[model samples]
Target chain A: MPNPTAAILIIGDEILTGRTREGNAHYLAGELVKVGIDLRQIRVISDDHATIVAAVRELSASHDQLFTSGGIGPTHDDITADAVAEAFDARLDVRDDARAILAAHYAARGVDFTPARLRMARIPEGATLIDNPVSGAPGFSIGNCHVMAGVPNIFQAMVTGLLPRLTGGQPLMSRDWMVMVPEASIADQLRALAETHPEVSFGSYPFVQEGHYGTNLVARSTDAAALEAGFAALQTAFPEGK
Target chain B: MPNPTAAILIIGDEILTGRTREGNAHYLAGELVKVGIDLRQIRVISDDHATIVAAVRELSASHDQLFTSGGIGPTHDDITADAVAEAFDARLDVRDDARAILAAHYAARGVDFTPARLRMARIPEGATLIDNPVSGAPGFSIGNCHVMAGVPNIFQAMVTGLLPRLTGGQPLMSRDWMVMVPEASIADQLRALAETHPEVSFGSYPFVQEGHYGTNLVARSTDAAALEAGFAALQTAFPEGK
Candidate 1:
């Protein structure tokens, strides 16, 4: 079978307009990789229903799992829940389980649970609630997609709560070798090696120091032996790694 | 007329893996906004042809302009040029202009112009070259889509060189008003205002201070007068500005 793959949907105008830098995608990428799920794509869209609906439909069909961050807040622009529910043709209403969680959370904080705060309790039909410990707003899992909060702290907490429940594929293993050789000089050889190792993924990152530019070669694969073989070949080719 | 909008495609695994914090997207978003182009979407994809091609095709069709950062270097994993060429159905070949620029750059730096370095000269057919002052690998513009170097320094320089050439739309104007009121209490009022000003985009950013959470309300639009009017009304609703 092919490798398990995942995608992320970031919904917020704050991110698109550069008002806020997003941390959820990067955090989720590493988290998914640890569980052997390759993060295939991440799309950041404004909190528009058409955009969110289109992205949700496309990503749901392509990846094994889809995690969405943002737009599940209590404001009017937080229409991701409604849009996602519409995308799946699922009815949306306040869930008893989610309401209980939010109510309890508000009580603990000595805050009144206003009607507007109930917006967080509204979830799609037939969706599993992803509990949030950091805040009262609960995330939900519908089909292949998991909808979470836009707040980085809340989103991270939701991911931690959700990761253990899902089934994962093989864990990805990786190794890196830093070479002092200029990237251009080793382009042909690296290309050849990349073609030879079809199962492995190799990447080169160039860094400049004291007016000299060199590259660090990273090879990753689920197979430990193949990863080692790829790393060894890379090291042998660029022995001066000095 | 609606404001001209642009989308960004960030191509690199380093970014998704959290190995490299992205500076290019943030810079590009600000530059696009300053030039009166609304940044609509941003998608970060790995060095995969199918993903890059699909994202480029979708974003290119939806927005007035599309920009791609990273994967234009002279390394093996730098497949963005080929993918973009294929996406546009344009042939990729060593352009004489790009070749001349890279050749002259290498000569000036006293670095050997190897065949692998010639890979940097490859450009999509009918593309305009975007000059790179930091490094020799030149960025290119194919139709409305601008492909630039991924390195922060080089990408910034290329954007400065390219932005002057494009015709801009009505500059998007904005006004920020901080509210001490909780988002929940203002949800109803904000929703009513949002419905009234259908053309303007309003977003709420919540922040925590001394264990108290409040929100900053930002109203944005291409119409300066409308934005100011909306800001005035919004501030009146929440007179106690925090």
Candidate 2:
């Protein structure tokens, strides 16, 4: 059976403006790969309602699972929840359960539960909350979409809470062989070898390190035996590491 | 006039599988912003031909400029040039000029111009070559789309060669103010202040550092005076920083 495919939608202007570099997509991609979910695409868009709504609807329909990060805060630009609700045509309001969670957490810190703070409690109808162990504001999962916080720490915590519940296929395994040869010199051999091992996916990444051109040939497959065979064949083909 | 819009399409399976963390999108975003080009969106897709072709066609039509990175090598998995040619409905083949460039470069190093090496000479009809100072393989530009190498150094060199030739608007100016206060506590104030400075764009990024909650308010505008005024207003409103 094919692995379940997923798409990530990153909503933020900071990323587009080049203010913030690291995001939840990288971490989520690694985690999803380990859990046997194929991450097919990742889109980084601005904090706009129409764009977010369109992306969410489109990605959710195409992929088995959809993950989103950013725009779920208390500020005016945090419109992810509302956009997601609009995408699913679901009613959005402050739920007692989400509100209670936030209220208690804030109360423990002696912070006021202002109306703005209450915005975090607003969730789409028929959605389950994804726990945020680091922060009180909870993320939500609606339909096949898992919405998480933008902050790296909170996003990681929510993903930890959410990934295990979903069904997964066999984890993908990868092996790499580094060769000190130009990719052009080995392209034909690599192609022939890849055709011989049809089950393994081959990727050739060329690099220039210390003024020396080289290529890192990576082989990935869910079957351990196939991966090992492909790796062994690659090693034999370039015995001197070139 | 509004800034010219641009979109980036990153073609690689390594990114989707989280095998590689850094890519060309971040570097391109910062460069585009510096040149007054509004980066509207960035999409990272696998090295599938149909997917890359569709993305190229869509992004090329939607934005004023489209930049693509990856899959433009001699390896079997490198199909970007062919896919881009299909997207533009242009015939792709080894052109004499491109072949001459590669032949001369390889001859200097005493390397054979193998058929695999010759694959790098394929160029879409009616496209102009973008020089790669770091490597001999030349990138191409068809219409508003700029196809570049996946390697960071080569990609940077190609971008440097291309960006200066395009028309650019005024560079965007930005100012940031960090306050040690909960975003919820300052959401209303932030909204009001944002409204007062209608010319600038405000973005609130909340963080938790050393058990303290804070928000970084970033104000961006093409007009330097307006950005400074907005930043000053935010500082006055949150003098205590909490």
Candidate 3:
């Protein structure tokens, strides 16, 4: 069976404005790779309502699964839940369970659960909560999209809690050869190797280090035997790279 | 006048597979903000022809400018130029000028100008070349799209060389206050400030550092005077943030 495809929608104006560097997408990308989920695309867009709704609808409809980060907060700019609800044509309001979580956490700290604080408890209809261990508030999974907080540590924590529930395929196996030569010098060998190994996907990355040009040739496949054969062929073709 | 809006499309399988971490999007996002161009969106997709073509058409039509990186190389997987050409309805082949540049560079190094090496010389019709100083091959600008290399240094160089040719707008001015309080405590003030100053965009980012949670209140505006006024209001509203 083919690996399940996934897409990530990053909703934030701060990232688009260059105020904060994006970390969640990269983090998710690495995590998904471990579980053999194919991350086909990643989109970083602003927190506009129409944009968020459109992005959620498009990504969710196209991919097997979707993940989103940012815009779920206690501030005025936090509008992801409303936008996502509108996309799926679901009603959104503060749920009793979510509100209860916030109330208990805040009551222990002696902080009043203001309207702004209650905003975090608002969730869409027909969604299962993804637990946030660091904070009491929970993220959620509605349809194929999982919406989580923008805070890095919290986002990472949420993903850790969410990945185990997902269906994963076989982890890909790969081999690499680092050759200290201009890519042009080895283009013929790389092309031949790529053509010979139809099961493996090949990549050639060139870099300049210490005034010498080099190419890192990588081959990846799900089949271990094919990857081993490809590696042996690589060693025969470029012994210097070994 | 409003700033020119732009989008970046990154084409690569390595990034999607988590073999490579993306840096070009973040670098270009910061650079675009410096030149007063509003970066509206960023999309990272794999080396699929249909995907690249669709993304190019969509992003090019929606924004004032579009920038692409990766898939311009001397390997079989290097299909971005052809996909972009197809998207714009232009002919793609090895152009004489691009070929000459590669030929001369190779002649200086005394390396064979093999078919694979010649692959780098392909250019779309009606496109102007963007110089790659690090390597001899040139990237191209066809219509609103600027296609460049994916390598970090080369991508940075191409952007630096290309930025001066485009029109620029007023640089954005921004101010921020770091308050040792949960975002919930300042949500009301943030909402009021957002409503009062429609010209400025306000954002509240929460972080937990050293076991204490805090909020970073940021305000941005193109008008320096408006930003200064917003900073004053922020100081008055959250004196503890000082």
Candidate 4:
């Protein structure tokens, strides 16, 4: 069977405004590949309700799993929970389960759970909580969409806990060969090799060093034999490659 | 008039595979903000033909301008040119202008202008070339979509030359303040402040350093006076913030 496919939707004005560099999507992409989930696409959008709702609906329906980061905080700009609810057409409020988790955590620290703080507990009607080890507030998985925090540390922690619960396919394996040659010189052969090996994916990344062009040729596949065969064929075609 | 809105579409398989981290989008986002272009959305999709065609059409039509990076090289994986052509319903061929640039560059270097090398000359009809200072292969702009190379150096070089030609609004300005307070404590006040100043965009980025939660409050606006007034209100509301 094919690997489970996923997409990441990021909601934040800070990212769109370039105040903060987006690392969550990159982090998730790396982690997803390790877990054998193919990250099909990533969408970074601003904190607009209509845009968020539309993206959530579109990505969730298209991919097997849709993971979203940002806008789950206590601030007014954190409207992802409501937007997600609207996307799935689910009732949203301060659900009792989420509220219980936040209440105890804050009470233990001698902090009052203000109305604004309680906004973090506002979850969709039907959703499973994804544990956040770093923060008291929890992320939720409603249908195929998993909503997580924007903070990198918190987002990573949530993903660590959430990934294991979902079913994954065999991890993709890859082999790389570098050669000091322009990509055009080998493009014809590379194309033929790629067409012959449908099970493997061929990638050619070009770089220039000391006025010489080099291509990092990579072959990736979930099937072990196919990966080995494809790599062998690639090596044969470019004997000078190493 | 509002700032010209733009979207970025990244076409690559390496990004989705986690083999490469996407930095072009971040770099361009920062540059666009300085030039007064509001970057609305960013989409990173695979090098699949159908997906590329769809995204090119969607992003190009939705925003005032669409910038695409990657898949313009000579390798088999490089099919962005064809996909873009299909999206715009333009006939793609080895245009003489682009061919002359590549032919002269290669001839000077004693490199053969093979069929594969000539693939770099293929341009969608009616497109103007975006100069590539680092490489001879040129990016093109057609139907409000500017196609650029995926290489970081090439992409940035293309953007530098392309931005000046497009119309821009007033440059956006921002003010940031860090406060050692939970966002919840300031959320209510922030919401009120934001409602009072629709001209400025209020962003609250939360962090947990040590055991204390802190928030970085940012106010951004194209209007200088609006930005100043909004920031002043924010300071008045959170007197302890600094």
Among the numbered candidates, top TM-score falls to 2
Query: For candidate 1, what is the TM-score?
Result: 0.94
Please give each candidate's TM-score: 0.94, 0.97, 0.96, 0.96
Residue lDDT tens for model 3, B1-242: 88999999999988887788888998998889888999999999999999999999999999999999999988778899999999999999999999999889889878788888899999999999998888888999999999999989999999999989888787776788899999988999999999998888899999999999999989999888888888889899999885
Interface RMSD of each: 1.7, 1.1, 1.4, 1.3
Instruction: Give candidates' CA RMSD values in order.
Output: 2.0, 1.4, 1.6, 1.7
Fnat values, candidates in order:
0.66, 0.80, 0.70, 0.80
Q: After superposition, how far is residue B104 of candidate 4 from its true place, in Å?
A: 1.9
Complex DockQ per candidate: 0.66, 0.80, 0.73, 0.78
Best by DockQ: 2
Off by over 4 Å in 3: A109-111, B108-112
Q: Tell me the lDDT of candidate 3.
A: 0.91
Instruction: Please identify which of the two predictions, 2 or 4, would achieve the higher TM-score against the true structure.
Output: 2
With a 3 Å backbone cut-off (N, CA, C), the pairs that clash in candidate 2 are none
> How does residue A179 of candidate 1 score in lDDT?
78
For model 4, residues A33-119, the per-residue Cα lDDT tens digits are 888999999999999999999999999999999999999999889999999999999999998989999998888889889999899
- lDDT by residue (A158-201, candidate 3, tens digit) is 99999998898877777888999887777788778989988888
> Please, what are the lDDT tens digits per residue for candidate 2 over residues A1-242?
99999999999999998888855888999999899999999999999999999999999999999999999999899999999999999999999999999999988988899999899999999999999878799999999999999988999999999999888888889998899988988999999999999989999999999999899889999999999999899999988773
Ranking by DockQ: 2, 4, 3, 1
Worst 10-residue stretch by lDDT in candidate 1 chain B?
A: B14-23
Model 2 spans > 4 angstroms off: B240-242
Which ranges in model 1 have alpha carbons more than 4 Å from their true place?
A240-242
lDDT of 4 by residue, B96-165 (tens): 9999999898888888889998898999999999999787899999989999999898899999999999
